[model samples]
Target: MLWLRSIIYYFLTALIALAISAIAGTVWGVAFALCVVSIACLFHIFNLHRLHRWLENPQVDNVPGSFMLWQEVFDQIYAEVRKQKKAKERLAGTLDRFLSAAEALPDGVVILDDNDRIEWCNPASCEHLSLNRKLDMGQPITHLLRYPSLRDYLKQQDFSHPVIIRITRPAEQTLSAQIVPFDSTRKLLLSRDITQLERVQTVHRDFVANVSHELRTPLTVVGGFIETMIDMPSSDAATRETHLQLMYEQTQRMQRLVEDLLTLSKLESGAQVREEEVDIPQLMQLLRTEANGLSQGRHTVEIGRLDRPRLIGNHDELHSALGNLVSNAIRYTPPGGTITIGWEKRDDTACFTCRDTGIGIAPEHIPRLTERFYRVDRGRSRNTGGTGLGLAIVKHILHRHQAQMIITSDLGKGSEFAVKFPQARVIE
Candidate 1:
C-alpha cells in the first residue's frame, strides 16, 4: 500500500508540471519540475542513510522513523527486531538454568566432544578426575585419565552399562562412569563416587564368609563324632561315654555360637533401647558372683571403688556388657591373675572399668578388638570357649546407652577395658 501511494504521488507531481507548462512558459515549468524531483530524491536519500546506520548497530529505540512510506517500513523492521531479541533472551535463560542444575549435582558430570576432548565439567568432575577447567579444557580425556581400562572403555563405545574404575589422582576413589550420546557431535560423561558402596559390599562378603567359616568347624566336629559312634556301637560303655561327652561339649559350643550371633544381630537391628533405673552396686555384686563361678577359684575377682550412683539404662543389656568385660578378663588372665571390677565417677562421668592382669593385647589389636570374631589368639580363643562376638556385643550395647569404650593395654602386662557413660545417663 505504501509503495502504491508513493507511485501515485510522483505521478500527480508530473501532471502538475505538465499543467504548469501549458499555463506558463516551457522553461519555467521545466525548472519547477526539476526542483520538486530533486527535493523528493534528497528526502528519500536522507532517510535511507539513517536506515543504513541504524542497521549497523540496530536497536529498537533508535529505528529511523522516515517520511511517508518509509515510516511503515521502519515500524515493521523494529517490531521484528524486538521479537528476535526476546527469543534470544529466553534461550539464554533456559541455558543458564540447565547449567545451574548441573553444577549443584553431587555426582560428577563431564561433557566430551566426539574426538574425546574435554569440553566442560562440573566441580564434582574436577575433584573426581583432578581436572582444571581453565588448564585441562580441550585436552584428551584418555591422556588425563591415563588408565588402560578406561581408555578401552571409551574406545569400545559400548555404553550399555557403567564401568567401575578406581582413580588415584585426587585420592583413592572408586567411580562408576558411563558415556551417553547427548548430541550429534558430543557425549555426556557421567561419574558417581561409589567408594563407600564398594567398601560396604566388600564387608558384606567378608561377613558372610566369616559366619560360614565360624559355623563350619563345629558342624564338622559334630558330624564326625556321630559317625564314629554309629560305627562303634558295640564298643565298651566307658569309651562310648567319653565319645558322648566330647560330642556334648561340641554341641554346647555350637549353641553358644548361635546364641552370640543372635545377640549381635539384635543389637545391630536399630531397635529401641530398653530404659530403666539400674542399681550400679547391686549389679556389681551380681557380676562378682558370676565372675567367681566362671573363674572356678583359679583367679581372684575383686570389686573396687564401687560408686553408689544409680544409672539410667537397660538393666539386662548393661549386665551383658559388663559381664562380657569381666568374663573376657577372666578368660584371658592366667591362674592367680587379679581381675578388678569397679564403678566410679571420673571427670563427672560414671565409668565402668574392668582391669585385669591378663596376657595383655598388642597395640595394633586393640583397635579391632570390638570387631566380630576378631581374636588375638584364635586357638586360645577356641580353647577358652569364646564365640568371639562378646566385644562386638559390648560395643553395640554401650553405643545404645550413649557411652564410649576406651581400651588400653600393654603387651604381656595386662589390659584395662573402660566404659564411660554420659552425665545424662548417670543418676547421682
Candidate 2:
C-alpha cells in the first residue's frame, strides 16, 4: 500500500509538470519532465545517504527523521532494530545467569575452545588446577595442569572414566577430573575434590580385609583344635580338657570381634543414641571395678573425685566409651603402674579423664589410635584381648554425644585419654 501511494504521487507530479510544459511545446514538455525526474531522483539519493549514515552509527535515541516514504521506511527499520536489541539483551542476561550458577558450583568447571585452549573457568577450577583465570585464559589446559596423568587422559580423548590425580604440594589432596565433550569440538573440564571420598574407600577396603583376617585367625585355631580332639579321642582327659579350653577361648575371641563389629555398624548406621542423665560417679565406680578386675591387682586403679556427677547422654554408649579407655589403661599398664579415672569440670565443659602409667604411645601413632584395627603393637594388642575396635567405638560414641576425645602421650611415659563433653551435656 505504501509503495502504491508513493508511485501514484510520483506519477501525478510528473503529469502536472508535463501539463505546465504543454503551454510551450512538446520539446519543452519533455525537458520539464526530465527536470522533475532528476529532482525526485536526487531527493531519493539524499534520503538514502541519511539512512546509510544512521545505519553506520545507529542509536535508539537518535533515529533519523524523514517525510513521506522515507519516514515510513525509517520507522520500520527502527522498530526491527529495537526488537533485535531487546533480544540481544535477554540473551546476555541468560548467559550471565548461567555463568553465575557455574561459578557457585563446588566442583571445578573449565570451558575449553575447539583447540583445547582455556576459554573460561570458575574459581573452584582455579584452586583445583592452580590456574590463574585472568592470566591463563587462552592457554592450553594441559600446559597449566602439567600432570602427566591428566595430560595422558586428555590426549587419549577417552572420557568414559575420570582420571584421579593425587596432589602432594601445599597439602595432600585428591582430585577426580573428567572431560565432557560438547558443541562438537569444545569441552567442559569438570573436577571434584575426592580426597575424602578416596580416603573413605581406602578405609572401607582396609576394614573388609581386617575383618576377614581377624575372623580367619580364630576360625583357623578353632578348626585346628577341633580336628586335634577328634583325631585324638583316646588321649588323656587332661589333654582333652586343654584342647577344649583353647577352642572355647578362640570362639570367645571371635564372639567379641563380631560383637564389636556389630556395635560399630550400628553406630555408623545413623541410629540416634538414647539420651539420658547418667550418674558419672556411678559410671566411674563401675569402670573402676571393671578396671580392677581386668588389672587383677597388677596395677593401682584409683577412682578420683568426680566434679561433675551427672552427664546428659546415652548411658550404655557412655559406659562402653569410658570402659574402653579404662580397659585400655589396664591392658597397657604393667604391674605396679598407676591408673586414675576421674571427672573434672573445666569451665563449662566436663572431662572424663583416664590417666595411666602405661607404656605410652608414639606421637605418630596417637593420631590413628581411633581408627578401626589400628594397633600400635599388634602382638601386644592381640595378647591384651582387645577386639581393636574399642577406640573406634569410643570415638563414635563421643561424636554422638557431641564430645571429643583428647589424647596426650609420650613414648615410654604414661598417657592420658580424656573425653571432653560440651556444657550442654554436663549436669554439675
Query: Candidate 1: lDDT of 20?
Result: 90
TM-score of each: 0.82, 0.87
Q: Compose the digit string of candidate 1's lDDT tens values, residues 325-421.
A: 9999999999999999999988779999999999999988998899888899999998999988999999999999999999999888899999999
Candidate 2, residues 193-254, lDDT tens digits: the string is: 99999899999999999999998998999899889888988989999889889888888999
Candidate 1 ranges with C-alpha deviation above 4 Å: 1-55, 58-94, 167-172
**Candidate 2: regions farther than 4 A off:** 1-44, 67-69, 141-145, 157-159
Pairs with steric clashes in candidate 2: none
Computed on alpha carbons, the lDDT of every model, listed in order, comes to 0.90, 0.90
The local distance difference test score of model 2 is 0.90
By summed lDDT, which 10 consecutive residues of candidate 1 come out lowest? 164-173
Alpha-carbon deviation at 350 in model 2, angstroms: 1.3
